[model samples]
Target: MPRAAIDVISVYVRKAQKQRSRLPSFRSLAALEAVVRHGNIVWAADELGVTPGAVSKQLGSLEEELEAPLFHDGHRLRPTPVAIELAQTLGVALHLLREGWDKATHGLDTGVVTITGNASLCMHWLVPRVLAMQAAAGGRAIRVTSLHTSDTWWQSTVDIAILRHRRVPVGWESQTIGTERLTLLGSPERARRAAERGIAALGGETFLAAETRHGDLDRWLAAAGVGADTERRDSVHFYVAIEAALEDMGMVVAPIALCHDLIAQKRLAAPFPACTIRGAGLAGAYNRAICSPRTAESLFRWMKREMRRCSILPAV
Candidate 1:
């Protein structure tokens, strides 16, 4: 608990650790861990179920083998430089082992998938595809969480993600799930109102913006070869933008595939041609490494299957 005590333990354990020519066995490592915890031969011996004399003899052997004095401060034990490096490395490796076991035993894949995504992707595209995935998988449950912040929710320890960024970070793997083609999705009543006034009437109404970079409005207008007037624009993130549109606040660009079912149900309708984003590929993202263990492979296969079924693009 005390800072000095932590430093002492850290030093000596590292020292005892470094004395070995090769990595220590679990028994030896455990002895080292015990010594670090107890801080002395007598205490380490009692905790490790070894004689005090034996503990002292082992420590001496370790130091001799490493040819490095592990304890610092003649009055206080110190770990040699080599010992410190070994301790930190072993600590991380041990933690990784524990984490691997935890992920394996927990039936995490049989349960929810904490997928990070914006509402527009969820509502228009993923929600339906997941439902289809659930139906085919038989008995697997899927959970979709909303990501509303400009900060990446996918950066969290989520199970999977439908990201919307162009670059995947180092050490991470990504897969192209599908592309977002922009088309106008209006609430049924809103479509009727616009129809009476003519399609150009949309130019006069305050449109909902998808606020984030590469959002629906930005992608759509860019795809359509148009730009915002800049003099007047209303912007909001996916969830807010969708809610506003549902409330008939204003029309927004949506992917045709995402809104097709709603249009059939007479809840939503597309007023424009579907087109790929201007100067961009279809707008959306997916990382391959984040799936839950059980579904990771299967869902990956399903995702590929679904994307192919819906798209003409070659699998990546």
Candidate 2:
């Protein structure tokens, strides 16, 4: 949670304490929280084990209790700004309550550390090295999950998160692991052709890009001093884009750490190594309340060391 959100929650708590009799029902609050969090009444109803009509009735009760309009009638229920902030605060509060209950029932140290990151990073980089990371943690079980969004941090039980962020969120600890280096990769034949023709050949070939990294191609081309417009194909994930490139569909600009093994194995080729662009810095973040300091530090060190081992070179 951010500092502003915490302040909002604190103010809400103080008000609720002052007017104890006016506090909304827990069921109504839960319905509001679920509806706002998921942005769908049907989904919230399913999660709460009820029907959409029941959820709607709960929301109406909550709105009447709060004396504020929380949603606007439209094609889809659009939450008002107040509703969004209230839902965020409620989410944090519920997560804290759950954490407290878990801590009370089970001991603090569960002997298992959960790490989460983007799907591409988890698949291409972290999953393959899970055993090594576990060994580094002194035999503690390591769990890795692929989480694509950053907004669900409070809902997750992950101990550490590897994210492409430079700033740490409030009440969490973070350290910069490394700056991701983005390189243009393709099959050997396409790479060899591009290498022979220099940077201009990039304009002639189709560029494969991920929707997650929509601007990478233009950024790389600008860094390489190439201004020509090129055909581009988009994929949902970077790993998918790289996979397409492997099938000789098109060239892809991707993080070297995710493709270095393929490059080393000659399955992929870095056509213009000198044109590599610096992508976002990778940060390892952990909430101190959930992860022990020693465990967080050990995993951070292991991540840094493993990242340092990934080197990109042109395919032989």
Candidate 3:
């Protein structure tokens, strides 16, 4: 290209870069979001701790950036259709961004990080080991809330969660903790009897069921290529059923990881080899609207490291 043509191109490129750099900052977007949310400049200004004129100037600057009017400045300065739609989405995004910033900069260094999970997990796994995790975190507190196994437990304000989900909800993040597998546990005598009698002999024994995992026995039996014609006896939770099995109540279908300590101690024995069920696993989740990035990252890292050594998680 000739010198003059190259100079013109260079000048245009610099101007474009300058314009791109001038893209609306969070301040202007915040002002716009608040304005659209409140539906009035004065109210938005009050909410943002700024004067109405300042809010209007911010909107004006934003409008210049997009080269489009955002509001119909008629009798009430009504937001246009585009403005309303943009506000609806940007409000959520900006709220999440602000929460992440706050968490990154101002997490409770000495206070508790609340976590929630299913009752079985809290009892059998996390509760026992959380104190060590807390100590590792330099005395930051760890508070756990136990939810019913069937509860849609992820839509909460907790910093972390350990639960099973078919699909995560919108505005949330998740990580796979472990893939669930089932084993039939019983007392020493019962296990030997079942093993000798081809697991079908235990059909008449009391089936200590986990209320949380309805149909778990059926699933386990089917996976082991056995028919499900067993007696129905239910326990409140997995731990309860495991305890019952330890005391020779009945054969219970349980997660292998949860039954490890008992089996190792000879408190419970596997009547049949463990079978990986088709579709069951646990995950950790947090609401993006509430959880800070720093909190989420830290908790995920802590759980990943802890679960690998403690539970039957899939290899990373």
Which portions of model 2 show Cα errors greater than 4 Å? Answer: 1-110, 166-170, 311-316
* Candidate number that wins on lDDT, 1 or 3: 3
Report the lDDT tens digits of candidate 3 across residue range 48-162.
9999999989999877766568888678878876576667667768878989988766664436777787776777777876787676556678888888766766555566777
Candidate 1 on 94-147: residue-level lDDT in tens?
Answer: 678879988776545556565556676576657777777676445476776767
Candidates ranked, most accurate by lDDT first: 2, 3, 1
Superposition error at 222 for model 3 (Å): 1.6
Give a tens-digit lDDT track for model 2, residues 175-287. Answer: 99988888888998999999999986567789899878878889999998877487888877777887899899999988888777788788888888888888888999998
Q: Each model's C-alpha lDDT?
A: 0.58, 0.82, 0.72
Model 2 deviation from native, Cα RMSD in Å: 20.8
Ranking by TM-score: 2, 3, 1
Predicted structure with the largest TM-score when compared to the true one: 2
- Candidate 1 — which pairs collide? 11-79, 70-78, 71-77, 71-78, 72-77, 72-78, 124-258
Indicate the worst ten consecutive residues by lDDT in candidate 1: 278-287
Residue 80, candidate 1: alpha-carbon lDDT: 56
Using TM-score as the measure, name the better of candidate 1 and candidate 3: 3
